[model samples]
Target: MKPAVTPAPPAKDARRPPYAGYAMAAIGAALFASKGIIIKLAYAEGIDAETTLALRMILSLPFYLVIGIHALVHTRARGEALPDGRLVLRTIGVGLIGYWTSSYLDFKGLEYISAHFERLILFTYPLFVVLFGAAFFRQPVRSKALLAFAVSYAGLALLFVQNMAASGSATGTGALYVLSAAVTFALYQLLAKPLIMRIGPQLFTCVAMGAAGVAVIFHFLATHPFEAIFVSPTLWGICLALAFGATVLPSFFLSAALKQISAQANATIGMLSPVVTILLAMAVLGDTVSGSEWLGAALVILGIGWFTLSERKG
Candidate 1:
């Protein structure tokens, strides 16, 4: 008699647990938040923004290369077909635009603006997050979320004014540049989320970083003298820290977290990053942000909390 047929094993579920996702996101945020403090140190040592970007990418290249190579190996071992060239090309294009351009713009803005206020506007990524969610995911924005976004943006406005005053800039021109950086960053994050979904976060990030790194290296060669990179050990140290801490660690953790959480949740957690950045700046750099900035941060946090806790109708 024929033996009874055994049922096939159930398929693996790719969806990650919510708590795990949120935790990874928090870790990513912490790593990213620390970037400002490191950059300030690098700047103090006379490493200009372009050089910093190049060096950071240079330092980060190995880590991403390992991940990318591993991805290729794993796919080959599993006998799975290669990923589509079109997808890779798309990632390369978006990565160049998002990672390289956005990073340069942010560093440029930071030169003319306070890190804390740059973070404040940067936190406005949630606005773009929601828009992306609505447009791509077809997520219905609940009223509470709308309210939260409004409150947070208001806080951003306050921080903007404070940043201008702190910089002693004329007519808030510096703030406009900061705002422009924010807008570009929002676009990048939104573009990245979907791409990360298609390619596993680690593989996706590795490739993206590779794309960005290549672009930056070319730009560095074209525009600036190579002498800036060899200036001093202190510069090298800061650049290494920026790579390991700011780019590599944060990108990996954030991508891992994205596996579990929606883009909106990621954006919400991102709001906390600037607050952490501000505290670190004060502690490390002896920089002073006004009371209004503090108040604005508090409001932004509260708004984010309210949005997270509120229920949405089906």
Candidate 2:
């Protein structure tokens, strides 16, 4: 009997330094951070969160469609075997809930919450990623990983400490929503990560984004309608920026980065996003963080850095 062939290892050493991957992850986080500030600015101009998200998705539609069409043409010309139809369906399903619905919830939350506050909650993604990874994939939980997780949560507590004190009561409604968003966002990263590994970043993102765009467009018509979207030029411009700069561009970089980094690393690196958003808010929105917020942001960045940098190949 003939022996079976085992696949060769990836060309680049698996144990090579993770710096380049971390750098790309940082860039992707920066792009994502730009979204909240821009969305807030658009809100100040009177565009509602639903309308803003819809418009952003709409503007990004053409970019994804163009890529998908191009791929279809090229594949037909090359007579390559067709991709599995079920894969497309799965991508669409995840994109609909993960990208479209989660984004809607996030923007809506931003309307009611401070940018700093929103960021603090969002950064909980690292813990969710680690948990999801362990539960689903049985990834090992190291002592350092546990410590990093603890520090990150401590940062989140510090940022929200004032809010919790001010509340003086717990209804659990608002916090529940934020927690839901965080979980969905984490699932988004985890679900897409495997697809990205399978299909490559560009194609996966294009299809997933197209799916998200379609869902959001339908949501806009059902909820906001055409008049809401066409209300003003400033609103349209903000939406355009959200599409290209916030949604489209960042997602591509993030999807690509996922190919190079673990989901846990991606979430950890995204800890920088809160810092970037806070800085942007300060510059553009005239928002200033109190000493506590500053400390919280510092802790988040430090904890994430410790986790990513300390993970040396054994």
Candidate 3:
């Protein structure tokens, strides 16, 4: 009798480039950059940070709910066990740190700072990620990574000095808030990858976002009246855009990208964010950019682009 043969494993698509993961990270960063612009627009209508955040999470919740439910059902049909309660709780905690606390601080900071300044400050999170990862996770810091870090942060320092000189004392308070947000966000970047690898990216995003949405909603309810959420149709439209475009899409994209790349690489790729935010703020909010800001931005782009190319080659 002839022996039965097993079919060969399917080949990976050679047409798809290795850099696709980097492209996903870039797209995620660009979409996330729009978030500050949209939130600033909502604030222009006299909405408070809590209310704007509430509206964003409210609009965002349904999508996460649907996706979360679908992912559970799909996992069950595939005969897989659900994530344990401990991992689930840990993910929820990370979500709260990353999304709820960080976002709240960020929204509050925006009240006192320009979107350009806010984004640039937030861009420092990658430095925290690299530092924390080396300290806690024992990840080695390569010399090339140090060079990239130095170049990027030197540019940020230039922009920071320029912005700080132009703004009021309130800038100090805002910078503190956003800097705290950056730290928590950096922690989130460190914690998320292993969890994402265990569960799929879609499921991980849904669970994390679901927990964050609930936390934001509860915080809003505890502090503010429902009437606070009522705003002009235009404001609602802006919140809708912020929710779907900035929050939902980018969350999923970043999660998926994490599955393909290291967190440090993801954070470095996100340096594109502040530049995008600067341009959008200029165009939409009539915010002016200085020659120094332009030079600093050029430095940022050069650093990130060079780092990305080197990573690809490596």
Best by lDDT: 3
* C-alpha RMSD by candidate, in order: 5.7, 6.5, 4.7
Tell me the TM-score of each prediction against the true structure: 0.81, 0.79, 0.83
Overlapping backbone residue pairs in candidate 3 total: 0
Best by TM-score: 3
- What C-alpha lDDT values do all the predictions have? 0.77, 0.76, 0.84
Local accuracy of candidate 3 as per-residue lDDT tens digits, 1-314: 98999987667865554487888899999999998899999999988889999999989989988998999999999999999999899888878888899999999999888887788767667667877999999987767767877887788778777878888677777878888888889999999989888987667878888899889988998999877777889998999999999988997788789888787778777877888899899999999999998887777666655666675566
lDDT of 1 by residue, 104-165 (tens): 87776677666676676666655666666787778787677788888987887777677656
Better of 1 and 2 by TM-score: 1
lDDT of 2: 0.76
Of candidate 1, the 10-residue stretch with the lowest lDDT total is: 305-314
Candidate 2 error regions (>4 Å):
1-29, 74-79, 164-176, 251-272, 312-314
- What's the count of clashing pairs in each model shown? 0, 0, 0
Per-residue error (Å), model 2, residue 68: 2.2
Worst 10 residues of 3 by lDDT: 9-18
